[model samples]
Every structure is written in C-alpha cells, then in structure tokens.
Target: MDAWVSHAGIFSATIKFNEPLQVAWVNTSGDQVTPGSFSLDPLKVKSKRAYINQTVPFTIADEAAFSAFTSAMITQPNFTWHLTSDKLDVRALAFPTAHGLHFKKDVTLNGMNNFGRARLARRLQAARDDPAGGIVFSATTGLDNSSAFNVNLGTGSGANTVIKPGSNAVTLDGRLVPQTGTDALATTFELFTKYLNGEQADVVATGKSSIQADGRAVSWLSAGLTALELHVPFVAPGGAVSPIKAITIGDMSLEFSTHAPWAPVSNSRTVLAAMELPFGFGLEIEEISNRGRCRACQLDG
Candidate 1:
C-alpha cells in the first residue's frame, strides 16, 4: 500500500486465555481486527486494532520475584517523551519583543497536530504537568490513535498513572500502550525473570529517542490481563511459583483511580495506597510495599 504509516510503532493486538477469569474483557465495540506484522523500516506493530486479551493463571514464584514485580509497579521513572519527528524541520520563531510568552514561539512543536508523537506528548502532558516531565506516561498517554494504550486498554495511558501516587511518575510500564501481538501477561512475567537475572535488554537502545530508566521502560509495561484459570507462567531460574497473594475491599477498577502527574509527596506513593487492578479486572497484581527495589532504568540481571 502506498499509504503506509512508517511510524505506526504499534497497532492492533489481542490476548486469549487458557482458563477462566474472575475478571473479563467486554468488547462489544465490534472493531474489525486482522493479522499484522512488525518491522523496523516502517515500525510495523500489531495489525488488528484489538487489545491483547488473555486468560492467565497469574502467579508469583518467590518473595524476591514478588518484590521485583511489585517494585515494577511502584518504582518511578520520568520518561521524557521526545516527540520531534525528523520528517519536517521544526524551529522556534523567537521575536525579541514578545515579552517571554509561552516557552518560545515557533519552537518546532507545531501544536502537535501533524505527527502522532507530538500529539501524544500533548495529551500526555496536558493534565497540569510539564512537557518534558513524563513520570509514567505510557500508562497515561492515550494522546493519539497511534498510541498503544489508547489502542489497547481501550483507555490506556490516559487512565490513572498511579492508583494515586502523589508524584509525577506513575505505573511502571506506562500502563497505556499501542496494540501489539506479544502476550502481555507472559511478557510481563518474562521481564521479572530478566530483572531477577539482571540480563541485558533484548534490543540495544540507540539514538536520541532512547531514555534509560533502569530498564523500567522495557521491563515494566504489560497490558492488563483476564482469565478464569489460576495459572501464570513466570518463573525465575531456581525459583518456584505460587498463587497470587492479594486481597481487596473496594472496587479495584480504574474509575476511582487518581488522575495526576508526578510530584514529590511526603510519603511513599504506595504507602496506605490501594493498587488499582487497572483497565478492566486485569491480573490483580498483588499489593505490597514500595521498598524502592524496582529499578526501572537498569536491570540487576
């Protein structure tokens, strides 16, 4: 097709379960989804514009593993979304007489209308926040149709970064994401393994767009999951698995979740806070303390 989206970094996605779920995905939207592909030339991602929905036997192996996973949720990182595409030359028209109005004039950010990156950045930073200070935005960047979370969670990054963190950094994987084919549940678990092992990320990062936040960008994000079965396949070497250990009283849905940007609080974000299951009833991540163990930029492995 001549009309191809070279920067459609991500597209459609979906997930299926091997068992039942206490939670489920209700997609009556009837969006026709077809198979797709992934490549570098055009940044091809998922094809069908469906969120990856899978039924997983969500489980935790050992305490360390559990800690790692939970840390991913609570750990903080400010992803500086550099949304300047090279297609067009963006520059500022700073008139010496404009009396310091609005950062700069013609500062290359052409109102974020022409490209997906700029648009996503605009929506991501719209909620009383700084343009370059994205705490945990992928989880809240439903900035544009080209965004993954906006495509997947049906209400991704634009949701709640923190169930209610009093900080700019939000959820680990930036919860909101563009649709893709990788099994999110499985991938999330795999990340834990890598974290446990402290291995180098699969894809070496390069260029100005790459921001290293302790591997948090690569390891943290997993689309919400659903299934009836109580089995999950995430096991670190020499580690054993067990059923998810979590309890809740109020609704764990994303509705009551707090919508705010990253800020310094007097206490730990997870202190006396409730972890929202996110989106629909995704795999309810067992709640635990934010021991500052989840290092998102670099992995221990």
Candidate 2:
C-alpha cells in the first residue's frame, strides 16, 4: 500500500432516528428476556459518512444522582451518547459551512454536461422566483439525487443553509468502508466503548473531517446481536449509462452491537448479573450513570 495517499474530500450522508425504545433485560441465567426491565429511551442513531451533533438532556430521579449519572455518562464505557441542549427548541446547522464543503475542481465532472449546466441555470432562475430563494448555497454543489423530496432553498436539501433553531449539525465523510467483518466489529466496539468511557476514539464527526474525544463527546451507538448499523453510499458494479439513471447507491447500512449488564434505577437502583446471550446486534446502552449507595445498605438486614 502506498504510504503517501493524495488527499481527502467531502461526501454525502443520510441520517435517521428511529422511534424511541428500550431493551428488555435478560437474566444471564435464562434464554428469554426478563419482562421487568426498566423502561427508558434507548436512542437509535444511524448515519452514513459521519455522526450528527445533537444535544439531549439527562434527567435523574434524585438531584444528587443527577451529577453522578451525568459524570459517569460522560465517562462510562457502557453507555452511548451525544450531548443534548437544555432548550429542545434550539436549532443548530445540520451541516457546518467551514467543515462540510469538500472541493474537487479537477475531478472529471461526471454526469453534469453542458446541457445539464444550461438546464440548471434555468432551474436556478425558477428557484430565484420562488419564495425561499435567498437561502445560502454553493454553485459547485453536486445535484441532489433523491427526487423523493421536493427540496427548495429554505427547505434545505443538498444546498447548505444557515443554522437556525431546530437546525442540526451533521458530519459527512467519504472513505472506503468494508461491508462486514468480525475483526472490524471488535475493533470498532472497542473504540466505541472507549468513547462512552470518555476516552478518545476515531469517530466520524459531522462538519469536521475527524472529531476527537472533546472530554464532552456525545454520540449514539446501536445494539445488535452481531453488529451495529451504519449508513453509506455504494456504486453498482457498472457505472450508470444515463444521467437520469445515475445509480449512486446511497444510504446502504452498516451494523454492530454489544451485550453488557445494566442496572435498572428508577426510584431505587437494581443490579443484575451480566446477560450472556447471542449477539442481539441491535442493543444500545443510551444512558449509563453511576449512583453510589452504601453496599451495606443494599444488603438484607
């Protein structure tokens, strides 16, 4: 392999937050999941290229526990996270300008021909006449491929727009990713665990080319029997023959998962032995806090 590679560039990405859910606790002794597991939101975050920046608030049953939990969460190896803002209504740009744009003035402009440029000019004129034309945009951006959504300037699709309330910051990355592998999964999980434990790890962060553990890192991780999911684009074996048929395989998935013991702490804390089961590949530990009670107090009188 050549040690001196040329350079890096920007990439497109897709993100999704599935409906909130909780994993049923399985006693390490049984084959089935325990029904009495605590109810909590196990955040499911999936993104291609990079993970988005989000701020979520952590609530605790007691004020004292809040600090411990927050501290542990910011430092635990078992929990998954991304920071949350106190004001849920605040909007942050999903794509930051300084970090998001990647230029390649030299790479052969693929599908865009002279005719396409002309058509784009006409479309731009039409857009200017539209109500939301003033939003910031780059003339060099690649066209939006998914026609499923009718995006306008303000609607904010491929074009970069100003960060506003409810706006989110997402990281876009471009690199050769493998489909699936055990060694890869193990290594990735180790990094993820370290990240949750407030340790440094290589995570594709949004807006920035790469993000380091800022000592305040918060990103979501998925739980799966075998692997967690990741989003990515694919190029079919044969390139598209027609511009209309430019089959840029976007949003294909990548998955990884883990199994560890969890303490169900509501008004009180309950601990169970670690559940050793088949890799359920989609189990995620969203928030793990450290609450200290006298060990003697936890024992039966």
Candidate 3:
C-alpha cells in the first residue's frame, strides 16, 4: 500500500544549463597553428600576422528543460556574432564563418507544483490486513507482475502526482536546439583543450551535459563521448504552506526518497519513481556538482 504525499505549497526557481559545445582540430602537417595560435617573431618581422587561414568553423548546442505547457520560449542573454560576413570571406576574422558556435538551454519554474501528490492509504490498509502479513516496500517502478511492491497508479489523467494547493501559477523557462555535423564539435574540442589543457578533463563548464557518440572516434585530437549533461532543477515549496512533518504508523517511521527520474512528456514509455514525502512537506535544494548526475531529494521533519 502507498501513502498519500502532497506538497504544502508551490515550488519555483530558474535552472540554467551552461553546456558549451567545443571543437578542436588535430593531425595537421604543419606546426598545427590554430586560428589565434602563434608565437612572437624573433626578428619582430610581423607583430601580428593574423594566421586566420588555419582556423575552422563550428557551433555548440545548448538546451534547457522547460514546461511543455508554456505558450512561448524566452532566450536569456541572447548570443551575437562579432565578425561580419565580409570579414569571413576575406579571412580578416580568425574564426570567420567557419568558426564554431555554441547553443545553450535554461528552464524556469512556472507551475505551482511540478507534479501532484499520490495517495497509498488503501493499499497500506490492505497490506496491514493481509493474512500472510508480508508487506515490503521497493523503489523500483515498472509493469512486471513478479515484484511484490509493483503498485499501479494508472496513466494519463489517472496517473498520481504531487500536488500543491496555493499559488497555482508557475513556469519552466528554458531553450532546446539541434546541433549536428562534426565541424562544430571539432572546433569546440579545440577551445576546451586550450582553456583547461589535457590534465583537467573533469573541469565542468557552466551547463549540465549528456553527449552521445556514433561509436567511432570523434578525433584523435580529443576524447570520445557517449552522452553529457542532462540536468534538472532542484525544487523548493513556496507561498503559504505548512511545514511537512514525518508520518509514523505505530513505532515504524514512514519515509521515501525524492531524487526521482524526470521525464516531461506524459505519454513517454519511460517509468518515473518520485521520492514522495508526507503531506504538508516543504521543498529544499542542495547545490551539487554540475557534471555527471545532478540529484536532489524532498524531506520532512
């Protein structure tokens, strides 16, 4: 049996993903001169030769997770091109049109609550009365009949969620864009190598990431990737709401984990198991590392 878990009030915040797409060029016959890569002439022949011919063109793809119900998407800190098309044609600009581009996404909290609470009062009651007296709780959620704790909560409108009462208004503001071709990736790699060097591979940039590879070497110049940065926001209850207190049945304490998987679409095949707190619980977010997995939990006193 499952217990009813409800949010005392609305949760809201803005989540930013600073995932930067990088490009790097390797395996060059010459000294491997990058766009702005050069050394001072011994004789001081040319102060700045501007070896712009050796540069490449690329773009980065940045994305944010936003509410699907939003009527419009907002672009924060819009990106601009510093070099003109004429500069690109004449090779006056080192990056030119061939330079790399990076696109990012950010999601804002716009809904009162991300999800509604689920109640398991009936199931728990049934389990308590069962003659066998064998009731165990499991976090794994799926449709398999073999599991004892496989509670079916229904689908679509019938699906259970964590609902908050007050301030029913909120929104998740973020961006989503497609990034293709090797040109952009290559350039991105180059920038990455220059900024951090080979010794610092774990240095995370501004955004969360999830990069996938085609199973082939991207370049001998850089490391291969499967997927990078898939970040979600940490939620905290706001507005008028009572603090959630731990629920207890007899001497046994009731608790659940809140760091659950987030899949925005309702019809998607993937299953979600949210960490549910007792009714009137408040939300809080803990800062975590930007790279790899970014997870948070909902707790009660």
Clash totals for all candidate models: 45, 40, 64
For residues 63-126, write the lDDT of model 1, one tens digit per residue: 3333332222222121111111223211222322212112111111111111122111112211
* Best candidate according to lDDT: 2
Q: What TM-score does candidate 1 reach?
A: 0.14
33-138: candidate 3 lDDT, tens digit per residue = 1122111111111223222122222332211111111101111111111211111111222333222323222212222121222111111111122233322221
Name the top TM-score candidate. Answer: 2
TM-score of each: 0.14, 0.16, 0.14
Candidate 1: clashing residue pairs, number = 45
Runs in model 1 deviating more than 4 A are 1-182, 204-283, 286-301
Summing lDDT over every window of 10 consecutive residues in candidate 2, give the lowest-scoring window: 110-119
User: Would you give me the overall lDDT of model 3?
Assistant: 0.22
Q: How high is the lDDT of residue 201 in model 1?
A: 24
Candidate 2 on 1-301: residue-level lDDT in tens?
0011132223342222222222222122323231221112222222212332334432233433233322322222232222211211111246542322221111111110111111111111001221332222112122222111111112223333322222223222223233258888788567435533444433321221111233221222101101211222221112221213222332322222233113222222443334331221234468755443222223244
User: In model 1, which range of ten residues has the least summed lDDT?
Assistant: 103-112
1 or 2, greater by TM-score: 2
